[model samples]
Target: MRKIAILAVGFAPNQSEITETISLLISLSEFKAQFKIFAFDRSTPLNHHELYDLESLNPKDFDALVLPGGIGNATHLSTWSNDKIKMTVNPTVEKIIKQFYEESKPIGAICMAPIVVAKVLAKHNPNITLGENFSETHLVEGWKVTVEKCPSTDYITCRDTKVITTPAYMNDATPFQVFTGIRGLTKELVEMA
Candidate 1:
């Protein structure tokens, strides 16, 4: 079985983190072996919700990296700082995420997760535009690029690159509806692995 990692930062009362967990699980169910979840907490704080810091875990053990979207990641990742207040765990997660990308492993980000990818790339290569507008809640900013056989409203996948973005409301969907897009990606991930 292929070992996969679903990376998360904070699970504070936010729609992005909650839906992202649901989306990751729903996607994993279609595969033979579910991914191992790792939550990262530099503060060593307790997460009322589990899987709050999945990204902070070591990436060497997994075949691919999955990032869940949220405003916390976007704001923390884009900015650089030495101050403790501004330098939170999410930024650390972003740095690790860059390492994952540099390793050339498959990464899956849904909804605003793509924003994390955009943010990292923006620091160096600002040429890539996600869309025209920016969202405070979701943290999506750039021209949207979609793929075939993916959810229209809540999901987009970079099939060639093995990166995915899901809608904010994806987890609210019925089980049948939720797995459609994720299953497709699962197949791709497994095949590539």
Candidate 2:
């Protein structure tokens, strides 16, 4: 089984972002895949949440990395808040992303999570999608990423790197649409693996 590392926010995370991808990956008959979740906050102990401390693990252990999008991603993965205009990406999360990039491992990012990808891969100017929101599209473009508007059921793969992205709930999509987006993201990552 291939192990994929999923990065999530420590606070109230969007459950669907993580659950849908995981469920679809497990249901695949073509390949067996397993996932390990890591959180941005290291101080919080794991409980009902299946998250492990991201700082404690080596990026080398996983074949690929996944970033699920949610409001928490803006709050925790980066320094963005509801009231803040300027945001700083978290150093720890940035470091992990850099490690994955250096290793040439496939990365799957969804919705607002592409913001983190854009921040880390600014030099590459990776082509990605974040749904149809014009404001969010401009936000990522400011970081030097090439934004492609895509439907919630589809995804965009960067040409220069092994990064795949999808717009989950960012499109005001139904649950089924979000699930299809995640499933497409997972399939692309698995193919890269």
**Against the true structure, whose lDDT is highest?**
2
Query: Candidate 2 lDDT, tens digit per residue, 1-193?
Result: 7788888775444432454444444533345677777876545543444778878658899998988777777777886555333577888888999999999999888877887777788888889887887475676677677999999899999857888998887798887888788888888887796
Model 1 alpha-carbon miss at residue 184, Å:
3.1
lDDT of 1 by residue, 72-97 (tens): 45444433223222323355666767
- The C-alpha local distance difference test score for the whole of candidate 2 amounts to 0.75
| Regions more than 4 Å wrong, model 2 | 11-31, 41-49, 82-86
* Lowest lDDT block of 10, candidate 1: 126-135
Local accuracy by lDDT, each model: 0.51, 0.75
- Model 1 TM-score (2 dp): 0.61
Q: What are the TM-scores, per candidate, against the unseen true structure?
A: 0.61, 0.85
Q: Which sections of candidate 1 miss by over 4 Å?
A: 40-56, 75-90, 122-150, 153-161, 168-179
**Candidate 1: RMSD over Cα atoms?**
6.3
Q: Give Cα distance to truth, residue 77, candidate 1, Å.
A: 5.4
